[model samples]
Target: MKSGGNLEAVLNAGEFAITGELGPPRGTSIEAVREKAAHLKGMVDAVNITDNQTAVVRMASWATSLIVIEEGLEPNYQMVCRDRNRLAMQADILGASALGIRNILCLSGDHQQFGDHPRSKGVFDIDSIQLVNMVKNMRDEGKFLGGDDIDGPPKLFIGAAANPFGEPFEWRVHRLAKKLAAGADFVQTQCIYNMKKFRQWIDEANDMGLTEKIHILAGVTPFKSIGMARYMKNNVPGMDVPEDMIKRLKGAGKGKVATEGIKIACEQIEEFKEMKGVAGVHLMAIEWEHRVPQIVEQAKMLPRPVITPGSGEA
Candidate 1:
């Protein structure tokens, strides 16, 4: 076990795990965190706290994750390379560990052009791939990025993002391999609306035995309406929503789109559970945190598996 967090322990115990996300408020109130955490309290192994998702400047992920810990929930703190340089990234890793965070998702964040602060400059001192390897070294080798010794290093369950839907499809699986070689313990992909392509990508990964070495959580988001479906298909980058999916939502009409969306999500969850290489599902229900419990229960994922620490584990 890299960290004593329940997420690693659960996956290590060979059980299918569920993790949800929490997008913190734009301001400083912790009540939003409390309310959202309450909804996902017992339903998920961990709740991912996004760091300024889309670079819109929300509350810091590390600070919000502390509140999640207070709610008795494990946190998957996301850190993006666009906002912080190497020094800040290293400092945040140490700070997060001291505050009891174990899971960290390293990301090459979206450009500021899509964010509220379009005039701000980005600080991509290093890419996501390098960030993953750096975290691995900090945790396993007890050394800083500059090769300086540390009295004690942070224990982290490192993770990286993979966009199986992106272009040059031939290169996606190889990209996953690169991250694995860099020491990413797990990967969560972008929102999945086209399972055929996702399955193919995972198939290639399986052929390479990547699944045996790391946990791959298929990303899923419940579409709220036809407009949302169209937005993702036409506007969202790296999204591959098939025309049939859009037709399914459009066919639902205005009165029942959310209901239809939930059905589609449940169906995908069922399929993901049966996928050969998928170890879990990562639900990125943006601004829809309250719907998580109902979705999980309706999908028959209640009564989460029991995971206890094994030999030589704290």
Candidate 2:
């Protein structure tokens, strides 16, 4: 369910939500960024601009979020603490809200050393949980990090990340609980490839009485190639793919693997849509944005209502 104030309107109306990820350009030109935003404008509820995803250098998330707003698409802007201190982090949060971007996803970004930029220094001034608490304090208390009151406080829907398949599976539930305690309104999990693991994670969350506090969106990404799968497994922290899925993809012929990936993503989403704690599916189609609508439709998750003035409140 879209639990963010503005996003909730969409969920309350029975909208099967859609969100896209944009790796903002490292260079100045936003032509490519705008083009991607334009392509998903009416098709998605919002576009998430990843902040230095994979620890790779790229355009700043705040600027790209503003660009997405300018392109007429809502932005679920990503804020990672690996690159900024609490001071910068707080400023960006206020800045984004002032720019009219309502959704903020708190993340402890991947280390720069893990990404292509090994030479870049890593900054973990505050982990994702602290960032969540910071934003909540800012919005709820009407004060900045320094305890100074503002004329107009920022408003936003706070989100945090969860990885069920990460090492020590039980930690996922624990971390999620911590995030909720820190005032996370919603959670977008790491890309899920194994359903059993996801269910186990959800059950643990439910047992802790967390299922009701925050909206959980199952994250799914369609693999474009076997090589990419390997990259994800080897490089991405808090991500683990099963042997069976890799075997299946490996056995599939080159031309057929991507189709299998899409099919698997669709199946996973279909199942995730039915789970008890799940709010909805956040399809990270990545470069395959064009396939999202079809994937949702083929999975029988379409026919969403309009999220507008007349929709009743949840």
Candidate 3:
């Protein structure tokens, strides 16, 4: 019942929640946000609004979240530590809550070197785990990081990211445990291409009893082309796109690669539904928001569950 957000309600009700991602436009265009939100409305339990994802500047996540709310959809507001110190971070947290934002995703954003402003200095005042703990304290303890009491605390469903494909595989589950201990209410993993490795990671998480403590939403992203597949495999850190998958995209021939990618994503989502410790799926359609309804329909996850007010708590 924490936050009473749609995402929290769905998970608390034992429904297989489906969340989508919406990257804000590079400029201030309310129509752009609305258009993307239109594609996601009702197709997902919530939509994640990214915060200058991949180090590229864009419309602020909180502002985009409010636009999404106006479009009749819930937003999972994202905050990255790469650009803000504790002062700005806490200020935004309070503002986001006052704006009715219910879910917040804490992240250590991609390094500035990867973005348009390569020379920008990062303000990594605190890491993602610490961000999670700070948010939790603000919500539950009604106090700031420096121990000052807040008149009104943010009521948010806290979330953190995980990469099952991250190297030194043995350490993945432990990292998740750290976030859980930091009071993360839910987790969304990196896009899963290697099912075997992902299953192993989740199995270890289950073994440690972490699943009982937090909700894990398996991440899924559809490849638009073989080039995209290869880029993710060869370039994106912590992204494990197996060669066979790239081959599958290539096998789709010239005009059909996107279709095949959606098929692959749908298949992976089906498997996640059956996997233990997976509470739901986080569909990162990545500018392909128009295809989300089709993917949900094809995966038979349509007609997302309706959670009544006050039904989230027992």
The 0-to-1 C-alpha lDDT of every candidate, in the order given, reads 0.92, 0.80, 0.95
lDDT of 1 by residue, 1-314 (tens): 79888889888877788899999999999998899999999999888999999989999999999999999999999999999999999999999998899999999999988999998989999999999999999999998999998678998899899999898999999999999999999999999989999999999999999999999999999999888998999999999999999899888887999999999999999999999999999998888988999999988888777575674253
RMSD to the hidden true structure, all candidates: 1.4, 2.3, 0.8
Candidate 2, position 185, lDDT: 82
For model 1, give the RMSD to the true fold: 1.4
> Which candidate leads the pack in lDDT?
3
- Which pairs clash in the backbone of model 2? 1-279
Identify the runs in model 1 with alpha carbons over 4 angstroms from their true place: 311-314
Clashes of each: 0, 1, 0
* Stretches of candidate 3 exceeding 4 Å from the true structure: none
Best TM-score among the predictions, by candidate number = 3
lDDT of 3 by residue, 219-302 (tens): 999999888988999999989998999888888898999999999999999999999999999999988999999999999998
What are the per-residue Cα lDDT tens digits for candidate 2 across 9-122? 665555555566777887888898887776666666677889988788888999998998889878888999888887888878778888788889999887787788788777
User: Residue 164 in candidate 3 has what lDDT?
Assistant: 89
Model 3 lDDT, residue 150, Cα: 94
Candidate 2 lands at a TM-score of 0.92
